[model samples]
Each structure stands twice: as C-alpha cells, then as structure tokens.
Target: VEISQILLHQCQQEGDETADVGPGGDYRARNKLLEHLITGDETWLHLSTAETKPESVTWKRRSSPVTKKFKVQKSATK
Candidate 1:
C-alpha cells in the first residue's frame, strides 16, 4: 500500500498520466528522489544507532569451594 502510494504520489508530482511499478517486480521506483529518500532514511538510522550508547552489564560474585577450604585451614592454624 505504501509503495503504491509513493509511486502514485511521485508520478503525480512529475505530472505523469499513469504510474509504473518500476523495473524490479516491486514498487520500489528507480526514481532518483525516492532513492535519495531511502538512503537518507538509512543514513539517519545509522546516525541514531551510532550516537546511542550501549548498556553496561552488571557482574555478580559467586561462592567458591577453594575459599571455604582456605577459611577452614586458617581457622585450624589459628
């Protein structure tokens, strides 16, 4: 629906009598203006992604058997 709308709009803007669905079986026109729009949109998307910071992960500590053994040995020596 969007592709058809775009094609129809562009065709109307260019004063065309009928709209063509482009060469590729899809409504994605090879029109320079539409191509610019697509690339510009992609550029904005990339910029937005690049400007954002990634989230940092939190770390947790786990209990270990080695620490328990060391504690037992230390208590015995004391």
Candidate 2:
C-alpha cells in the first residue's frame, strides 16, 4: 500500500469525483470529467535518465588531479 498510498487513494477518488458535481449534476457527466484532464505541464516525469552527451564525458589523465564541477540542477519541487 505504498506508491504514496496509491497516490493518496487516487487523489481521494478524484476529490470525491469533484465533490459529486452540483446543482443537479450530470451535464454529460460533467463534460466527461472535463474532457480527460491533463495539465501539469502536459505531464512527463521520467525522473532519472540524464547523462548522455557521450555519457557526460570525463576522461582526464594528463596528470589528472582537478575535480569539482558540480552544477546540474533541476527540481525546485517539480
């Protein structure tokens, strides 16, 4: 029971199906639930596979002794 508690129980069952709609419900099932909703920057969170400019090249050996190149950021909470 973990993928973040099944995505918080499917986002609390889609917030109780949008709080069961209202004022007499069913406008074609609320426009088929807002026409298949998909925004969050159109969604794509692969989360990992990054280094591939020749696997982030790093083959120094002409007296190899100079290391400190940390500057690759992307995640201010998505």
Candidate 3:
C-alpha cells in the first residue's frame, strides 16, 4: 500500500523556545497559542522528516495487510 499526501504538522515550538528563554517567553507563547485558538489560525507546516512512503498500518483485529487471505480462510465453511 502506498500513501501519498501532505500532512499538516501541527506543533508548537513553544516548549523548546520556552526552555531556552525561560518562563516570560513561555507566557507570550501561551498567549499567542491562545490567540490562535480564539481566532482559529492555521499554524501548520510540512515536516522535513516527513516520509513520502507511508508504512501499512495493520489493525489489532487483523494483524496483517493480507486481510482477504484470512477472510477466505475464516469463511471456508461456506
């Protein structure tokens, strides 16, 4: 399976910035985040580390991506 899509990387760099600048900087960031929240701003970007090829996500209910193979086996009595 292949997944090709641009994902919006929604993350606040506030924590890291705050760590470097201290509590005062964090308060401003907090305020900024709050303002965005109130105004519904889209502060998203694509991560440089984003993978173009996504790994297949198999569920716990069905461990493998080969679901049809298992389905046929389970319904073999038919």
TM-score of each predicted structure versus truth: 0.21, 0.23, 0.15
| Models ranked on lDDT | 2, 1, 3
Better of 1 and 3 by lDDT: 1
Instruction: Count clashes in each candidate, considering only residues at least 3 apart in sequence or on different chains.
Output: 0, 0, 0
Candidate 1 lDDT, tens digit per residue, 1-78?
A: 998798778856865334457668666334545444643333222222122233433344666333221222222211
Every candidate's lDDT: 0.47, 0.57, 0.36
Clashing pairs in 3: none
| Segments in model 2 whose C-alpha atoms lie over 4 Å from true places | 1-49, 52-54, 75-78
Q: For residues 6-78, write the lDDT of model 2, one tens digit per residue.
A: 6666665665343344577744333333446555665444454468789777889989888786876654333
Q: Which candidate wins on lDDT?
A: 2
- How does model 1 score by TM-score? 0.21
Local lDDT at 20 for model 3: 36
